[model samples]
Structure formats: C-alpha cells, structure tokens
Target chain A: MKTKQELKEILDFIARYATYQLGSGVHTSRAVRNSRRIGEALGVDVQLSSFQKSTVLTVLDPESGEALTRVAAIPALPISFERNSDLSALSWEALDEGLALDEIRRRYRTLVDKPRMDPIFTLAVVGLANASFCRLFGGDWTAVGIVFTATLVGYAVKQRMQAHGVNHFLLFAGSAFVASLCATAALRFDCTAEIALATSPLFLVPGVPLINGVIDIVEGHVLMGVSRLVNAMLLIVCIAAGLSVTLLMVKDSLL
Target chain B: MIVTDMLLDGLFAAVAAIGFGAISDPPMRALPRIALLAAAGHALRFCLMRHAGADIASASFVAALVIGMGSLWLGRGIRCPMTCLYIPALLPMVPGVYAYRTVFSLIMFLQSLDRADGGVRYMQQFFLNATVSLSVIALLAAGATLPIFVFRRRAFSMTRRK
Candidate 1:
C-alpha cells in the first residue's frame, strides 16, 4: 500500500534512470529492460515510449491503481561506457537488494560524479590508434608518421571545437578536412599517399551510432533506430564532404 | 610468413581497440578484455580472408559472432554489459575503405550522369561498394546482437549479484 507521494517518487526515479541510459548511448531495448527491472523492484509496472529526443514513461501502481506518466528529454551526454555499465549494475542492485530510493539515488550520484579519463590522454591514444589504422591499411612507415602527426593536430582541433560548443556536423567536417589535408603531405614522398589520406579520418567513423542503430531496429525500436542511423549517415556525409575537398585538391592522386 | 602477418594483425587491432575504447570511457578493468576480444576477432578475420578465401562481409560476420560470444562470457566477470566490451572491439573491423569508396563513387556517379559510359562505370562502382558496405555493417550488428537473444537470461543478468 504505497502512498501517492511514493508512487510519484518511484516514477521520477525510473524516468531519470532511463533517460540517463538513453543519453549515454544505451540502445532502446536495454534501457527498457533496466528501467523495468527497477520498477519491478519498486512494485510498479513501467512502460516506455522512447524516441530520439524524448522518452515518455508511464508508471502504474498496481495496488493503488494510481498511474503517473512523465516525459523526460534525454540529455546530450558524451558516450560513457563506464557510466552505462555502472548504471546497469545499479539497476540490478536495486532489484536484488530491494534498496530504498534514497540509497539508490546516492549510489547513482557517486557513479555519475566519478571522474572520467583525462582528455589529453585520450587524445594521445586516439592519435596512436589512427596511426595503427593507417598501418593496417598498408601505408608505409612514412605514411604512418604523417597520419600520426595529422591525427594529433586534427583531434586537438576537434577537442577544442567540441569544448567550445561547435555543432557536431561542422566539427566532423572541420576535423576531417584538417586531418586529410595534413595527410596529403605524403604525396611528395612517392609512398602510400592515398592510403594515408584514406586512413587519416578513420577515427571519426561513428561506429557506435552505426552499430546501435542496427541493434535498435533489430530489437524492434524502429523509430529510434531510424533516427540514429540517419544521424550517423549525416555524419558520414560530412566526413566525405571534408575528404572531397582534399580529393579535389589532389586530383592527380585519384584515391 | 602467414603467422607473422596474423600476429601483426592482432597486435595492431589490440592497440586500436584500447585507444578507441578509451573514447567511450569504459571502466578501467574492462580495457584488457576489450583488447583480447579485438585481437581474437580481427586476427580470425584476417586468417579467413587471407587463407580461407572468405569475402569481407562473411568474414566480418564470423568475427563478430566470435566477439559476441566472447563478450557474453567476459562481461560477467567484470559485471559490465556485453555492449561495452564488444562495441570498441568491433570498431577496427569496420569497413572504412568500403564506406568511403561508396561515398566517393556516389559522387562520381552523380557527376558523370551526362556522359553515358562514364556514368555507367561510376554507377557500377557505386553500387558494388555500397552493397559491400551495407552488408558488412548489417551482418556485424546481427552477429554481435544474436548471442544476447539466444542466451537471454545470462545476457540480461550479467550484472546481477550472487
């Protein structure tokens, strides 16, 4: 026999829980599963109608017949697998321990407040990774060196622009243009100039959205799936637009 | 010679996975698992393509299947969802060349629409590249997510406390 206040609190918690997962790049099916798991522990039924921008979640208190529905706009958080994993674990803890909302919320706060990997370190690693990608594509050592330098410069620009709140499409285009333009230095060496150009922008491939979109569609979340795929496609086009500029400049390379 | 190539393939993929996996901010304990998964999947794909005569699409499907199963088992130890482990591992295998070629050829196709023979050649290239890219992408997603459906209870409860 839960009170109305209790029902509302539960509903709010569930909504916040699901929206964070959505924003942090969990697919639709998993978000639903985790939210419902929490709701079940709280002795309520949860239904979510999730879209690209918002999620409409309804909570039914079966005993009191008091239902509450709320729509939460998903935040635009950077994709954090650590956050996603901890949040999912939190849901399981709520279910397994039947923890009260205050305790659950406290744990959630701690998890979210945890510090992320240093951006400088991440940038360095990504530069190295993109260089490895160039090598994997059969670029010569000279081409790899060019790509390494190019990725360092381009990713730095991307990080700075992203921090300044640049639109993502523009960010991607600018980064690709910068990276590929730097990679074109390989042309003078008579080495794998084309391979360097091709691989310089591999770091911006939108892998998560591309894969998550397909998963959502396969799991029957059609609307969100389509929206994600469309977003990824646009980013790919932006990448190509940037590359095309370089291609136009290096027409003789014919890559 | 073949063994050296495969080892190089695995080594590069592991490095790539660690770097890309960092971008997503995964838990520190999960990086090693991501590296191992990427190495195994990418190396196997290399072998299949180089020695077994498998096309990129089919080889990718098999590699992703291996990654899916590996993550299902590995994720439980770390109390993380399989998605966290497999997504970065699969990044190196993305058909970057095919994806870009598709876009490059599409632009070429559109530009040459006035010249019949040129248009025909570009159109053919565009479709060929697009088909390969889309098929590989679709298969990778399907193969990775299939294990979750097959082992629903285990997949969903990987984070559960005993």
Candidate 2:
C-alpha cells in the first residue's frame, strides 16, 4: 500500500538510524540485525555493508523488486550503552507491535535526545574508579587519595579539551601527562608512587574499542576489526606518550 | 586475612565498575548488574592469582570467560545487549601496571641506548612488559568472546527472541 517515494523516505530513515547505531559503537552484527529488523517491520528487505566510518544500505521493495540505496557517513560518537539499548528496544517495539514510520522516528529522536550524565559527575566517578583500581592493586590510602585527585584533574582537563574540540591524540597525551605528574605527589609524600602513577591513567583505557575489535574479527568483519584494533593501538600509544613525559621529568625520583 | 583481602578487592572492583558504568551511561536499571559482574570477575581473578598460583594471563582469561558468559545470560534475562554488562565487567581486569611498565621500560631502553649492557637489560624489560600486557589483553578478549562463538545459536536466539 506504500508508494515508491514513501518507501524511499522510509528507507532513508532506516539507513540513517543504522548508521547512527554503527557510529555509536554497537557491534557490527547487532547493527545489521537491528536494521534488518526495522526493515522487516516496515515490509522491506534491507542489506547493509559497514566500514569503520561509513555504512551503505539497500532497501528492496518486496512486491515490485525495486530498490533504494542510501549511504551515510557516520561520525564517531562516544560509546553509550544506554543509546544502544534504547535503539535495540525501539527496533523490537517496531517489529513486535507493527509501529508506523512516524512513531518510530519520534521514539528514536527522544531516545537520542535524552540527557546524558552530567560531565562533572562522570569525571568524579572516573576518578573514584581509578583510585579504587590503585587500592585493588595494593596502594595504601595515601596513594588512593593521590590517584583520585590526579584522575579528577586529568579527566577535567580532558573534558575541557574535548569541549574545545582539540585533537584526540593530544587530549590523551596531555591528560596522561597531567595525571602522571599529579600522581608523582605520592612520591613526595612517601606514598606508593608506582601504584599511583600506574593507576591514574586507568580511566583512559579504550575498553569498548578493544572489546568491539575482537568481537568484530571473531564475527568475520575483518576490515572493521583491524581498523578498530589499529585505532585502539594508536590511543594506547598516545597514553604511553603522555605518561612518558611525566616519567622522564621525574626520572630521578621514579626510576 | 586472605578472605578479607579478596572481599576488599571485589568491593573495589565493583566500585570501579559502577564508576565506569556511570561514565558510559548505560540504562539506570543495569548499573547494579554491571557492578555485580565486575565484582564477580575481579574476585575470581584474585582468587586464582592468590590461591591457585595461576599467572596473570590465565587468571584474567578465566575471569573474563566467566564474565562473558554471565553477561550473555544476564543480558538475556534483562533484555539488554551483552555489551551493556560485559565491557564494564572487564574493565577491572585491564593490566594497568603492565601497560605502564611497558611504556616505562620502552623509555628506559631508549635512554640507555648509549650503554650497551644497560640498553640490553632495558630492551629485555621492554619486550617482557609489552608481551605480558598485550597477551593479557588478547586473552581477556578471546576468553570473553569464546562463549559467543561456542553457543552461537543460543546467543543469537537470546538476542532475537521477542
């Protein structure tokens, strides 16, 4: 009962939604599956090909066999498991309840537009987490306090740099430098400098990319997997570079 | 004393995972599950290292495997993606010391390039640290993902079921 133009518009929405999901760090298989579910719910057949930064989709009209292909350039977004969960739930609702295109679009908008956790709260928790890591690794109370402060300052710097749109590598390196430098205060106070230094930057490890990269390779998305791995490695190198600056500055005390 | 330390470790790991889950902004309802998974994984790894004398790599592998399977099961039960639980759970096992030592050794190696014997020692340290760090990470990933491959159909059905 849908006209070709109407179908094309629906396909466009599907393509955009899938691209957003992919960019948001859903594993490739899940992205494809979710999109396909959306397509089926709308009475279309969907084909998806995704790379690290872009996705191409084709929506085929079952009755007429005509197809509409759309390509979306997906800008990388910070990983948010809530967004992934909400989007997945949206697709399920569409399929299970036979929701129309307008309703789906409205839900998607609300889901993405939901307010994120406050940046200051995020920084505090990250600091607390890194400090706990220091304790778990055997640091004493002094070291934990130092690491908590170091991560707090470092993460605040990172947030500021990111807000100001600095390059990511610089952000990583700069934050690492500030954090490790602050961690050296433990050495001055006769606390465990090694543990503090080591745990201060724990907040910056690229957990999502590392896990997603392995999952992608295991699931046969070789190119995306490799790309993600390489990206993660680069981030690691940036983190190391940042930490090294601090170590070199305090080599007499640290080494 | 040992039991108390293990409990403390689990507690810290859970706290850290809660922080990570908060940062990632998973659904509010899933935070407790994430903390539980993280604590469980960290406790298992701590026990293996302390009691069984397993190396870091093996201990982390086992812990990650447990967490992975737990994530899949929990995800299904809660109707959320496995990633929502597993990523935060695995964060505590990340080899922070090994990673930092790798970079430190590399820097030491570079600086000692003028001293043949010192350079060799630093180079060996660098290689050792890098290998340990990388291997732990690889093992963690492999162990976490093995269940998905082994139970592919079941995992798929869990995700796909309405």
Candidate 3:
C-alpha cells in the first residue's frame, strides 16, 4: 500500500533511531522487531535485516519474512553523533516534502523493513559497558568518569571502526585501559570506595549496544547475536587483562 | 553485590531497560516514560520474586508481553515503537547474573566432587543453592508480569502507555 520512497523514509528513521541502541550493545534484532511493530502501525507487513556493512538493508513482507524483490539503502549517518547529541538536524517535517501522505506511508513500511548496516554503534556500546565494570562494582567516581572518557573515545572513533574489526577491539581496549588507568589511581588515592562510588554513573553512561544485543538475541539470530555478544565479551576480557596489568604495576604504591 | 541486593537489584534491572531503550533510539524522548515503566515493572517483579521465585523469568517475560499490549492500548497518538519502549524497561531485569553464577558455581562443584575432597559436598550444596536461586529469579520475573497480563486488556485503555 505504501510507496518505495515512503518506505525509504521510514527505514531511514529506523536506522537513525537504531544508532542509539547500537552504542549500548543492546543488539539490533530489537530494530527488526521494532520495524515490524512500526509496519503494523502503518498497516503494512514488513521485516528488516541489516548487512555486515553499509546502509543497505534486506527487507521482506512479514507474511513470509522473505526479502522484497528490491534492496533499499538508507544513509548510515548516526554512527558519528556527538556525545549527548541533539537530533534537531533530522527534522520530521523534512520528509514531508514532495510526497503525498498515502505514498509516504507505503514507502515508510518498506523503509522500516530494511536491516541496519553499521556496527559502530554496537562496538562503541560494549566499550562503554566494559569501562563501567569498576563503577558498577561500587568503585569510586574516577571509575565513572572513565566511562565518559571511553564514551568520547568510542564516539569519536566508532564511524571508522567495523564489526569484528581490529579497530573496534582496539577502541574498546583503549577505553578500558584509560578508564581503569584512572580508576587504579582513584582506588589508591581518591580515598574510600564509597566516596568514589558516585563516580560509577560516569561508567554507567552509554546504551546503544546493550539494546542491540538484547534485540538480536530476543529476535532469535543466535549466531550473529552471539558473535556480537562474544566480541563484546572479548573486549571485557581484554579490559580485565589491561586492568590486571595496571594492578600488577601499581600493587606496591598503595599500602 | 549487596549494594545491588534484592529490590535494588530489581530496580536496577529497570535501569538496564532504560539503557537499552536509549541505545536503540538515541534521541528518543520517551526515556522518562521508560523510567516510569521501569518502576512499575520493578514493583511487579518484586511482588512475584518475593512470592513464586522460579517463575521470575516467566513473570518478567509477561511484563514484556504486557508492555506490548499496553503500547498498543495506550500509546495511540505519540508514535512510539512498542518494542523499543517495552524492551528497555525490561532490560535491567534479565537474569544474566544468575545464569553466570549458576554455571560458574556448577563448574566449581563438579570440580570439587571429582577431586573427592571434603569440599566437594559443600560445593555440591552451593551448586544446588545457585541453581535454586537461578530458578527463583526466573520465576519471580515471570510471575511479576502476571498482574500486567490480567489487567492488560483494561490496563491499556486509560492513558499513553509509553
């Protein structure tokens, strides 16, 4: 019932919204299910699947959950949004131009059915979560602050990173080291653990990947979801490795 | 871990849900709505966890299901994705920690029992305890969503269910 162009707009909106979850490691299948929900709202039956890269998506009608005859592309721009961003640049009214309401609705359905193509949001989220471990454990403010640092670094580099890519791992590792590097000092010098516990919020910061991972697993993409999760788990392992090294290096300093 | 004990643990689960929502739609304005849902969800999960124990997963899953029903019922005008709204409010409650502890402690128990040390039996007891705890957590989650399910038909009619 919807036009191809309207579907494109809807998919673009889905992609824009998805970046938020990707940064938290929540998973993307939520996006798929989410798209389906949106499709239902528009009175259409559609499903979306993301490729390993690019904004290209494989869309299908929900009755069969198979790919539509054609592939559509949405600009994958949110991978590089600034820390605590405002999306005023992406005005809803902007999409209203040159398209009729019924036509817009049709395209929107098709668009919402497209899969997300980027993993930077996913990669960055895992980094933020790993950096939060110390804070979540009731550590100091420094632990929390470091989460912010990781967020900045991850946000800065996510666009350039890839799924299961070397830089993705590096960004996560770097964030872990930097966050814990500061945390190590705080653990020794910043006084009691409770005094620093408030800082955990800094670490608790960020959310995209957490959402993506959950969505993926819940939607039943066992391997792809697990791989993303495993990749995140590896980042945590590396963080622990880095933290252990920090602990080993600084062991004699505190007592 | 005591800091995250019981009710707080449950409350934080809702936080995870919000975090999940924020992740999917970064600029989503419905975060505060999620906050409220998290509170409602935590309260429901608390009642169920406090009672049925093992059904916690079923309860929470029901919470998620009710959330879907609620969205369709109440969020008619605002244009929110129901899954995006509902899932995050439930994110903080997933039983990963229990699963982690169960599997980890189980491995240790099996190791101890295999070595035939006196600690083996103790480890076995711990394994049982962990398993029971995991079941309890799941049941609580499942049961908590019960009220939502019953009330969901009428529950959705009142207001914006974001």
Candidate number achieving the greatest lDDT relative to the actual structure: 1
Q: Candidate 1, after superposition: displacement of residue A204 in Å?
A: 0.8
Q: Tell me the docking grade of candidate 3.
A: incorrect
- Candidate 3 chain A has its poorest 10 consecutive residues by lDDT at A81-90
Residue A7, candidate 2: how far off, in angstroms?
Answer: 1.9
lDDT of 2 by residue, A107-202 (tens): 999999998888888988888999899998889999999999999999999999999999999999999999988999998887788989999887
Backbone Cα, N, C clashes tallied per candidate: 0, 0, 69
Question: Using DockQ as the measure, which candidate wins?
Answer: 1
How well does each candidate superpose onto the true structure, as a TM-score? 0.97, 0.97, 0.47
Candidate 3 residue-wise lDDT, A3-110, digit = tens: 566555555554554443343232355444444444445444555555423223444445433333334433333332111122111112223243343554455445
DockQ of candidate 2 (2 decimals): 0.70
Report the Cα lDDT for residue B155, model 1.
Answer: 93
Docking class of 2: medium
Q: After superposition, how far is residue B11 of candidate 3 from its true place, in Å?
A: 8.4
- Alpha-carbon deviation at A9 in model 1, angstroms: 1.6
True contact recovery of candidate 2: 0.71
- List where candidate 1 sits over 4 angstroms from the true fold: B109-116
Ranking by lDDT: 1, 2, 3
The list of candidate 2 runs beyond 4 A from truth reads B157-162
lDDT, residue A157, candidate 2: 93
Q: Give the alpha carbon lDDT tens digit for every residue of A18-122 in model 1.
A: 999999889889999999998998889999999999999999989888899999999998999998899999999999999888998899899989999999999
